[model samples]
Target chain A: MQVHIPLKKVVDNSYDITIDTLPKMNFDTKVAVVTNQTVSKLHLDYLLSKISAKELHVITLQDGEEYKNQVSIDAILESLFENRFNRKSMLIAFGGGVIGDMTGYAASIFQRGIDFIQIPTTLLSQVDASVGGKTGMNNKYGKNLVGAFHQPKAVYIDPYFLTTLPQREFSAGVAEIVKMAVTFNKEFFTFLESADLNNPKVLQEVIKQAVQTKASVVAEDEKEKGIRAALNYGHTFGHVIENETQYKKFLHGEAVAIGMVMANEMAVKMNLMSEKEALRVKSLLEKYNLPVSYVIEDVRKFYETFFLDKKSSDSAITFVLPLGIGDFVITDKIDNGTIMCVLNKFGKN
Target chain B: MQVHIPLKKVVDNSYDITIDTLPKMNFDTKVAVVTNQTVSKLHLDYLLSKISAKELHVITLQDGEEYKNQVSIDAILESLFENRFNRKSMLIAFGGGVIGDMTGYAASIFQRGIDFIQIPTTLLSQVDASVGGKTGMNNKYGKNLVGAFHQPKAVYIDPYFLTTLPQREFSAGVAEIVKMAVTFNKEFFTFLESADLNNPKVLQEVIKQAVQTKASVVAEDEKEKGIRAALNYGHTFGHVIENETQYKKFLHGEAVAIGMVMANEMAVKMNLMSEKEALRVKSLLEKYNLPVSYVIEDVRKFYETFFLDKKSSDSAITFVLPLGIGDFVITDKIDNGTIMCVLNKFGKN
Candidate 1:
């Protein structure tokens, strides 16, 4: 006989992204602000002043993507256990994408799961990572090979934190904004073509638009089972570039900047996009000082790396190619000959 | 400006529990049967004959509760990674509770999450652990101190597996069945009071009744935020006993059996259960050859261990005390003097 265990419960995982100054937040239960030494040195005092809890603790780790691993996650969990933090305790991600991803991952597994809020400091994370529920760490195998779709309770995106961001990092953030515009918003792309991000007002407007586009896509598909895969337009190739480079040569968004150009080349070859459209995207990345070119060392080896990607299935590589400036398509139908033709364009001479 | 991310989606995580001989089961994706040495020695070939998948792999760990830690979980994950098991892969928990919990926890975190089915071999896991979504490993802190509420895709409880189960282990399983009946169903409790589980028909009926009662409670509260904590009638005290003995002295269900008797004494002391009612419950446990008494070496030390329990928050300890047979009251209001008075009975002279 079959006994049905009905688990029908309305899960309200919805949260708001506030694009303004940091608000004074209070928690009745214990809270931990998980940050890197770099971010904490710059804004820990200010963050502590604005956030209060019955018992608040700060856990500081070394800065850089190199630190985003199981060891870092264990430190966070160890701190929670040492403090006797219960299930009701909350965590605050107080750094960039690496910190946000690790903090969210640690919260997702600590005592099953706990609530977390994202206070993204870097420009790249504020516009992209903070809004998405994807939380994970890089392993020996690949980046984000281990993770969970754990949404934060709220996201406080204060652009003021960008004042201390370096010029190169600021440009990296702009790459993601360009990606969002290229995939879904033509008007935003048009605005970005001429808009100067050095202007705080224009940057704020751009960040808001990017977040809105991502929010809509995520709202439609939270788990990346459908339209959500569209958001990873540049990530498929970008992941491989980062993997090949040992994640040391380029920043995440900068690598994605180059990845988008390669995808656009494939799109142009397939008649899905015009050469002019591809150049326009390349020009946008150039405007932000983002890398727009990479010479392929070995075409076959590069293609093989795609299988290691979480998006790839058993054999076929799923590529997100641009249909036009504001449209895209997800397909595994792109033949190797066409892909090689595109890769040969960037092959080392 | 506030950007709203509406993540409103209906999640249907319902699954069926089949209570009969293990049927022919098949999967199209890669499958791994996670079991222990003992269970594999007894029934691996039998299980392999009945189950088929596109790619079937067996992951065997050393048997016993002591091995249920991060190491075992990592071993399972390492095997998956080595075999290149993707998110679409499935896992079969083919042992008892430890295998089920660890398999479920591994599935919950591998590539964010994957699907797993429970094929419980022991009575304790079949009637109790198989149904609930709770999955995790014991840490240095406590038992099940770390876990997730990941429901199985399905549960296959084959009574035929019990034929090979040791007598002591069989009694341990009955302890869980007794715990279920004592706290939820009076009619079922009456049936179990005199039922000979050695009789196949009577045992099947009892298992079905126990599963049905659990299903109703789980339906109302998938997470233990409210009424679901009632199911932990014996676990709160049992966890401490297992912890105090370092999980070496008693089996999980055996500790729970003694825990139920302790709870009954507390209920009688509070005037919630009559002495006769408490004795009736004890008699039922004894009838199954389950241990119903445990001597506390240090009353205060045992009392202090409750704070480490996941169910307790800060200063208050939530006890699921019987209001009478087949009824309970979850209370934190019981004063320390009364608690000590009850502990004094179990205290070594």
Candidate 2:
């Protein structure tokens, strides 16, 4: 007789994202604030003053996209174990997307999972990475090749942190906001085209809008088994660009900005989007000083790299193309010749 | 304004445990059979003949409890990455509890969790570890100090693997069987007292009863937040013993066997269980040639070690005491003096 084990579990990973100044928080359990050196140097003192816990520890790692790997994860775990942190201990992810992702991944596997709170310091993370529960680390093969879908207990997005962000980084973040608008909300895209993110009130409102759009999509599909894949509006090409440059040449959002331009070109060629509409999207990105172009050295090599992407299967590369400003389609039907033709336009002879 | 992200998800981690000959299995995706050198040398061909996958690979690590660690976990992942095993790939844990646990953990964190099947070779794993979704590796702090609650997609328990198992290993597995009976099923405990596991039919029946008992407990508490901790009837003390010995002196099941005896003594002293009932339990373990005693070098040192145990908190050590043959209680109320008194009985002095 076959003995069936039914493991029925209902997990309510619901949490609030508060957009304002950093709030004074109280945690009875031990709390570890995981941040990078750059963020810690600027704001660790302020954060420490605002938070109180039974036991508080600060774990700081080097700041960069290159450090987002297993070594950094091990450092976090080693700190937790060295401090005798139990399953009840909580982790606070501070700094940018790299810190948030690594902290979330560490919390996911530390003693079989624990509670974590996201305090994304960078503009890109606040609007995108911090909202989603996707926690992982990069590997030699690709970005986030190893990870878990572990949602944080809560996400605290303080737009105040944006004041300290660099201009290029701020523009990089705008790329993600543009991504959200292009895929799901035309009105938001229209608003973004004219909106001045330099204005604090407007930026806060924009962050809220992007988060709400993402939250709805995530609520409908926690795992990317369905509609959630649309969130990768320009991510397919963006990942390839990041990999090709060894993640050093472009900020993640910068690569995505260029990726969105390439995708819009493909959409225009397929008659899914108009040339005028594509130009409008490019102009908006240009307003933020985000990169709207990349010169591909080898079109064929770039095409082959898509297969190595986590989103791609053994047979075909799945692409998310904009049908219009607010509508998109996920398809693996893009032929190799068409993809190469688009890449050739960006190719340097 | 506060934006609430409702991440409501219902996960049905249900699977079947088949107790019969190894059935012919087919998988379309890449399959990695993670086993040890010993198990592979003995039954790799037999297993390969019964399983077919699009791309099959075998990852062999060193045999023994010493190899259940981060190094082994890394090796498994490196192999998967080298083979370009994607998220859709499946892992088959093809050994005892150590192999089952590490394999399950590798699957859980490899690409943020994937599917895995358990083919437990030893009796201990077939009865206990195979049923629970508890997958982890031991660290310097303690056993199973780090892990994830990753359930297997299915479990195939074939007693035929036991034919080549060493007699010592066989007795060690019996300790876990005795553990299941004493905590949850009195009638089952009585049956185990006289059961001849050498008889294939009798062993299969015992395995079924144990798996069912474990299934019920796990179904109620997947994360061991409540009554499930009762299953750690022998593990609390066992982990300390394993750590003290550097996991060289005793097998996990053997350590647990001696731990059960120590717990029974504490139960009797607390009047939770009668001396006669405790003797009967010891006799049953002895029938399987399992160790019933361990000489403690220092009572105070042994008591302190419990604080380092994952189940214990900063102040209290949670103990699972048998109320009688078929009942148990989980409490941290047991004072240090009472614990020391029990340990003194087995003290070398």
Best of the candidates, DockQ: 1
Candidate 1, residue A203: lDDT: 83
Q: Model 2 chain A — which ten-residue stretch has the worst lDDT?
A: A307-316
Off by over 4 Å in 2: none
> Which lDDT value does model 1 have at B227?
82
What tier of docking accuracy does candidate 1 attain?
A: medium
List each candidate's DockQ score. Answer: 0.74, 0.73
TM-score of every candidate relative to the true structure? 0.98, 0.98
lDDT of 1 by residue, A1-349 (tens): 8799988777889999999999999899999999999999999999999988999999999898888888999899889888888889999999999999999998988888899999999999999998979999998778988888899999999999999999989988888888888889899999999897778899899889999999999998898889888888888889999999999999999999999999999999899999999999999899888999998899888888888887887667899998899989999898889988878888886
What is the per-residue lDDT of model 2 for residues A1-349, given as tens digits with 9 covering 90 to 100? 5898888779778999999899999998889999999999889999999999989999999999999998999899999988878778899999999999999999998888899999999999999999879999998988998888899988999998888999999999999999999989999999998898878899999999999998998988887888898988888999999999999999999999999999999999899999999999999999989899999988888988887777877777888999889999998898888898899999987
Pairs with steric clashes in candidate 2: A147-B112
